[model samples]
Target: MLDVRASLGECPVWCSNDQSLYWVDISAPSLNRFDPATAINTAWKMPESIGSFTLRKAGGFVAALRSGFWLIDRDGRLERKLIDAPYDSTHHRFNDGRADAQGRFWAGSMNEKRDANTARLYRLDPNLKLSAMIDDIMISNGLAFSPDGRILYHADTPSRTVHAYDFDETAGTLSNRRIFIRFEAENDRPDGAAVDREGCYWSALYRGGKVVRISPGGTLVGEYELPAQCPTMCAFGGPDLRTLFVTSARQMRDPEELARLPQSGGIFAMRVETPGLPEPRFAG
Candidate 1:
């Protein structure tokens, strides 16, 4: 475990080149790099809350911050502003995102006020073009793509449902949206997710205290109980991509609860049988 104690840790991405994990503390508003070998974490404070980010093909990162999309260099310097926040920055911000196999970046926004379904999903092409792909979303989360790149999985956290879409990697589009999985338990709110090479979708249940593995056919096949009640996201990393790293949150927790779960905001990891696909880099 990496004991960084983040406030709202999310978006764990594996950096195969350096054999390290990159993640963010949304509430802390910082970018972090964790090295498993040394158990050392490096951080970069951000001007605004950073929702998610992915490595760039050339170098550095393509991030979705509260203000908008940006190009940040390896040294944490903002290189350029890709676009302004498409929605009102006061009520909405980018939440979950990743790059597709084709090098296109996709991100979803969330309605912080929760008063309406005003959030939307967007796509950022390699040429710096931005487009809104899906709309009427509340809390956008659980963004992952199948290994074959033909399916995209997403979840609206407050709705407790995960959805799948027929993805067109070439044209960078989605179609035939359908319910992939729906949680009946009140605590099983789907958050961030990852797809293993076997096509199994692993989702971190926000308040459920566990990560569930769902079969490609939308069946709950396995589960991994976590020490923290609020695991925000998970990523597969390590030498062979067999280590499943999970990040959790400590924001707003009662003092007693925090004492009971001291590792509430720390990063945890475990071995897994099926390896995960290498994270795709933003081509732009």
Candidate 2:
């Protein structure tokens, strides 16, 4: 497995233009970028907790912070642009996010208190406005849009299932919620997910020690086992979008377990047969 040491690696995203993989470490308060060409790693420290991010149409990225969403310049200047989430408990914050075909940003939250229901999902526009999409989320993890942008896929950790919604691209609305796929409860819960060009879902299991490739009809076609327990997220990167980059986490592990798995919090890579859909850009 390709190794990328991370403390709590999450939110893996592929930047085709740069041919690199990017992700965040929320607990670590850092951002990561890996250059496949040189096998090099780069990290940036954040002033506060950062849940996830998406590419901006103009340049740079839009990131979700504990307080709200913000615009991050190429040089790492962070400007808080959205403040509508004041109701979010301080213990809970933004988590995984993905862009819709129309360039709107969709992100979810997780409860820091574990069993509490203070979490929710949100949709943010370039103008820095926040809209609540779903409520009572336990842990908003990975999210992705369908190849045709007609379906939106989302997963809440420890739930063991990924949910699908009928996406209204023009009106930015979601309906017809249904369970798309379910992972084994004995295994890790579904943490993050991505959709391939063929519309297959690539879901990373948190403690399951594997990533499962499921058909749109909910059939398991394949699996990729990982050396770590908490594989958080996955994204397809590379010149041809055939490389799968995965992020892992060290949280929730005991000291002994952490010692046993040195690569537990690092990133992993593998080659895949199918290419991934082009990541939708943020409307901003």
Candidate 3:
């Protein structure tokens, strides 16, 4: 229900306990929350770009900022620096990420140059330990997990493909990696995504102007087109978790594209027949 124009809108999260929706503006470098009941919007300026975050069980947020991962207070103030930037900030910065079911934070970096393969995916354990997972990635995006937590979904935007990995939920290990989807169009790429209770993967196809739902078997089942060409991400909200909230991006968009879709960076919502799985809270 939020129409706030973000330069680069991403990471729409539903905090059911608080009955609020949270999201981020990477180019604006801010964190925002909205209350549908009161139509109140709250924002906090971040020190650097924030790619993604997860709600904490202790009533705050654990986020992946360009500088590194940090614990943020409820009022959106920095509470603790969980860890320093693991990669060289001059060439790399955090792009997209989220938390796993085991309470471990997962974030990946992107090469600002766009052509370098000097990037990797990292995981922050509950104890605040950092470890690199996938390496040599370019423009990492679309981080998500399947409903049963048995599959981990990720994407390398430059390659225009989404990958599915056989996951070991208990150990947080990924194997048997396979191509979940590949775009034949050079401009169509996967961005952010979430899973539904039916075990279907809903992907926000950036520049494709639609959110596509694919069955667990990797079959395209449904597609919802949007006004914006760059829908960054989507998450389910509302009491029954049947409302799907989508965030789009206007940053770095061409002027002609922005003119056609005036509300390029605004947040939109739609009611869905199936309820989405609840986003998990970080135990640490």
Best first by TM-score, ranked: 1, 3, 2
Count of residue pairs whose backbone atoms collide, per candidate: 0, 3, 0
In terms of lDDT, model 3 sits at 0.89
The segments of candidate 2 whose C-alpha lies over 4 angstroms from its true place after superposition are 1-4
On residues 147-183, what C-alpha lDDT tens digit does candidate 2 reach at each position?
Answer: 8889888887867778999999888888999998877
After superposing candidate 1 on the true structure, give the runs of residues whose Cα lies further than 4 Å from its correct spot: none
Candidate 3 pairs with clashing backbones: none
Tens-digit lDDT track of model 1 for 1-284: 88788999999999998998999999889999988888889999999999999999999999999999999999878889988989999989999999999898999999999999999989999998999988989989999999999999999999999999999989989999999999999999999999999999999999898999999999999999998889999999998999999999989888988888888999999999999999999999
Q: Could you estimate the TM-score for every candidate?
A: 0.99, 0.95, 0.97
lDDT of 3 by residue, 127-151 (tens): 9989988887988888889888999
Worst 10 residues of 1 by lDDT: 252-261
lDDT for every model? Answer: 0.94, 0.82, 0.89
Which of 1 and 2 is the better model by TM-score? 1
Best-performing candidate as measured by lDDT: 1
**Candidate 3 or 2, higher TM-score:** 3
lDDT value for model 1: 0.94
> Which 10 residues in a row give candidate 3 its minimum summed lDDT?
1-10
